[model samples]
Target: MAFLELHNIHKSYFLGKEEFPVLNGIDLDFELGEFVSILGESGGGKSTLMNIIGGLDRNFEGEVRADGQLLDHKKEKQLDDYRRGTIGYIYQSYNLISHLNIVDNVLVSLNMTNLNNREKKDRAIELLKQVGLGDQLKKHPNQLSGGQKQRVAIARALASNPRVIIADEPTGALDSKNTAEVLEILEKIAAEGKLVITVTHSQDVANYGTRIVRLADGKIEDDTRLKPAYKTTVEQPNVKPKVLSAGASYKNAFQHLSYNFWRNSLIMLGTAIGLFAVLLFSGIGNGVNAFIQDQINSMINPNSITVMKNPAGKKMSTAKFEQSMSQFANDPSKLLLTDKEVNHLQNLKHVDKVEPGYQLSTYTLSYNSKNANGSGFQTWTKAYASDTVKTGHAPKANQIVLDKAQAATLTSTKKYKQLLGKKVKLTLPWIDKNNHPVQVTAELTVVGFTNGGQTGAITGTNYSTMRHLLSNAKADTQANFVSVNVNNSKNVKSVAKKITSIKDNGKYTFGAITVGDMLDTVNQYVSIASIVLAAIAGISLVVSALMIIVTMYMSVSERTKEIGILRALGERKKDIRRLFTAESVLIGLFSAALALVLAYAASLGLNHVLYSIVKFNMVQITPGNIIFTVVAAIAISFIAALLPARKASRLNPIDALSAD
Candidate 1:
């Protein structure tokens, strides 16, 4: 039994089942301390035997025994372990990863070992120094000369401390002087008591090794020993290999991403633009809804439900209730509530008090030869928030609180407060009990002013003052609607429902309206608009994902040789998959971060510009939105990279290494 034994190896290639035999009954033996050269011609099957011993070619008619233990090439994991622990390959091409420096390239093999980061770096540096290229540790492969590149590859193969160093034409590309330097390095490696197997076409190169086996037409013609095996001298520490961890995969992925960042940045920018649009539209919708609620709640009491005589004597939906406002405008007399109807609502459960109010469709206020016509005149009740009156108190007898616009008409906006104590003539067209139209007028004092920051800004007066004026004009004095104040705010909804349940002779008599109902209607519309705009903006994200897919496929094509290097270095298929997926995910995260920055900048700028007009910030991005954006970005990129990553992991190492 030898240190490594090959027994009767037979191999063939087939072109559509036409078998072409390459290796014919090849039997070989080797030891740990000898530098053996397999000297052969182009088609002499030397490379095929090397692939079998290196655990790269599994489909063959052969049994490879390493120190009397049979090498099971059929089991992929065992083959991977064999390659990681026993075999180190130095290719003719030098096969250095273009992106990594000399030290990092060597560390690629050392990464699979159970060494800490500091120990790995020290060992890689030592290996580079041993090859006489320590000063070029930070230089990439393309920047190095042919000799330097082969030295880096040799250093990398030696990093994992494998027992058998296999050099497949290691000095094939170098000149005489550099070739002598490389052969010296290989002899030194054999002197350290490791098996140095070199495959070569040059007779002079074979003569430099300890033994040369001449092969002609896939059969060994002669085996010659030029020198004795070097005695084992230096002992090495046991380097236990481990599977590639996710963190290492991500680090590799990030390095590749950074190297090609200028190309990937366009994808990130497109994705960020889409994500920013979604964030912006959603933020604006939230801001608009909040602004409307603030404006409405500031002027009206949320706990009070406005009670109106249902024209159809049945409960109406909010949409129907809105449509009925025109009906109220058409016949104010028919919509008027009588004393008995008002009392019926006042006595209901949870009813604090029902304040009978008149809502005039249109009214005119004149003062000192200036007039301002407005609409939605009503008698003020507890349903109105006290803060609505900015200048003075609520209306007293023969007094009215004008909308700020109406007061500003009679005087300058700066001097409008001066008119609070001034007398004004209030007039509106009304209907008599006989259904005849009449002009109702009264000279009143302006006690306060209101500015609701929305449309339908109307003048307000007390019930008694409006009744007195209507009576003086011989017009109808009945209240059209009443504000039903609930004792507790929480019960407002239930009480409003109870009011609708009230009936007269099998017909519903009243309909109730709360500030919540109106606000809910407004919020619903805003939410729909937000979703629609965000969905439209999301189209660009699809394009970005497609871009990522195309980019990953292109990466797979470009890094085919790198994939072969990693596979040969004992990285698992799953590791290759995760490497590509991790890169795409990083792209997603970077895009999300960019999107957030853009959204915030745009929102801040717009809010600043429009703050004076709306008196509020119109865009608000929440923390939840930020989190959702990041998660969405990651998911999209990960999913987009799946097929490409799978394709990359499934590539054949032999084919990939042969790719240009």
Candidate 2:
């Protein structure tokens, strides 16, 4: 039994429906320690036979039996293993990966073994030294001479220590002197108990081998035994190729990406800008919402709901009812809350207390001939008691608390404090039931001044004081509006909803408004604006994804031969896909990092510029936002690379190797 047996091999090529036979009825036997040369013309099928024997072209009808086991060419994994562990190929073109150095080129084949990184490196270095290019180990293929490049190719082929060595036109491009040097190396390789098969057109090259088989028109014409075969001193070890792991794939990906750093960086910059815009806008929205919430909290009590007439009914339109309420001083009966309604509100669920308040449409105050016009007056509620009192105390019965602006208007700024305890005459205007103008006057002492920057020209007094004045003037004492206080701030919304559902005789409904409701409305608007802005920013990410797709496709096209080299070196299709996918993920990671840094810097600059106006940081980047940005970047990039990576993984090894 021979080491390798090719039994009646038949192969052909097809152009549309036309078939061109390349190898017809070829039978050959090979053994270890034999240097066999297949001499032929250009179209005599020597290269085709070499390709089949090397496990590169499996589209043929043949029984390739290695050590008595019939090779199943239909199984891709078996073919890959044969190429990785059983055969080594040397091409005339010196098909070396341009980005890798000479030593690294040899290591590309050694990487298929189970050797450690250091061992692989040492093996690659030793192989390069064996080929007489030890000093040029770090030089790229383009930096070497033609002979040197061929030497590197030979070193790479021998790195795996395969049993079969297939050389196609090994010295085709070299001078006589370099050809002799290469021939000597091939003779030595055969002497080491390995099968050396050289395919060539030169008779001088065929004479170097121990046996020569000449082919003419795809048929063997002559077979000659020139010399006895050399036997090895030691037995050859059986070694299998190791599967490429994810870590190894990523390492190769990083090397490729680093070699094209500037191009990848530009793509990353484009993606980072999009991510930065989205993150920055989202942060701004958060900050704006917080600012509005802070302002609302300072202005109103969170646990209080303001109640008003619903002004909506089947007979009357809401607009018409609102108009009537605005003219309440003319027709006080339109929407005034009666005592019965006030008591009903006070007994509702979650109700702590109901404060009845009256607003007289118009009033005037005379303090020592200093006349001050007032819009309306309200009785102090628990909500109002929380206000900051700049001078004196809250208003009691027969006393009034004036706003700071109104107080400043009635006296000099320095004398405003002096007016706190002074007596003032207040006159209330009204239309009598019989359509007559009337006025009610009362003497009240100034009790306090409120920090009323939020509300203007409003006077606060006790409920009993307003009720007494109204009764003295024979006027309606119905409360204009009531404030419903909830037991807990969290219950404000539920309680407010219940209050709004309260109806008087099924004819009139009430309206409920809580500070939380107002804050929610403000936040809702801010959220909408933020979503719109972020969505607009998100368009850039789509464009960035497209850019990545284009870039990956270009990379696949550029590295077509590299893909072939890796496939020939026993890398799996999944390993090829992982290489490209890993590169894309690295790009995404870099983009996310750059975007986060840029967003942080932008937030700093924006906050620094807006701090004086808003008195707060206007941009807030949360941990969730940062994480979301990073994940989004990676997902987008991975999706973008899917098609390109698949294309690379599915490339034909033969076609890729033939590509320029």
TM-score of each candidate structure, all chains considered together: 0.89, 0.80
TM-score of 2: 0.80
- Model 1 regions more than 4 Å off: 1-8, 64-78, 219-233, 307-354, 368-370, 410-415, 429-439, 467-480, 484-511
lDDT of 1 by residue, 345-425 (tens): 867788888899898888888888898888788999989886988778899898999888778888878888889788998
RMSD of 1: 3.3
Per TM-score, the best of the predicted structures is 1
Best by lDDT: 1
Model 2 gets an lDDT of 0.84
Decoy 1 TM-score against native: 0.89
lDDT of each: 0.89, 0.84
